[model samples]
Target: MGKIKVTQVRSNIKRPQDQKRTLEALGLNGIGQEVEHEATPSILGMVKKVEHLVSVEEA
Candidate 1:
């Protein structure tokens, strides 16, 4: 299976609660934080939820 590298490129502070939670759920705690995860429906959902705050690349 392919994997994805998700990087938090923007700050989540002052954002909606749901967006903040989405970032946390993706294992991103702060800006510049990166997490490697298998490309799956759940992760894709979370990424979509916070697409403005993160950048994703195939890993």
Candidate 2:
């Protein structure tokens, strides 16, 4: 399987609570935080939740 890299590119300020939770759940505590996660439906859903606050790339 391929790895997916999730990076927090934008600030979470003023964002929805759920999106903040998604970022935290993904191990993103602050802006510029990046984490590697397996490409799965659940992770994809989390990514979608905070897509505007983050950037994703294949790793």
Candidate 3:
């Protein structure tokens, strides 16, 4: 599997609870915080949900 970097790019204050939890699951606590994870289907799905709140990069 390949790895990807997920960076929180926006605040979760106005976002849904699921998205906020998704960010936490991705290890993001605030804007600019980043976490590298394997590009598994499940992980990708989570990313997709909060796509607007984050920036993804190849890792």
Q: Model 3, 1-59: lDDT tens per residue?
A: 99999999889998889989999988899999989999999999999999999999999
Poorest stretch of ten by lDDT in candidate 2:
13-22
**Of the pair 2 and 3, which is ahead by TM-score?**
3
User: Model 3, residue 35: displacement in angstroms?
Assistant: 0.4
- Candidate 3 clash pair list: none
Best by the lDDT measure:
3
- Candidate 3 lowest-lDDT run of ten: 14-23
Instruction: Work out the TM-score per prediction.
Output: 0.95, 0.93, 0.95
Stretches of candidate 1 exceeding 4 Å from the true structure: none
Off by over 4 Å in 3: none
Ranking by TM-score: 3, 1, 2
| lDDT computed for candidate 1 | 0.93
Task: Return the number of clashes found in candidate 2.
Answer: 0
Candidate 2 residue pairs in backbone clash: none
Output the better candidate (2/3) by lDDT.
3
> Stretches of candidate 2 above 4 Å error?
none
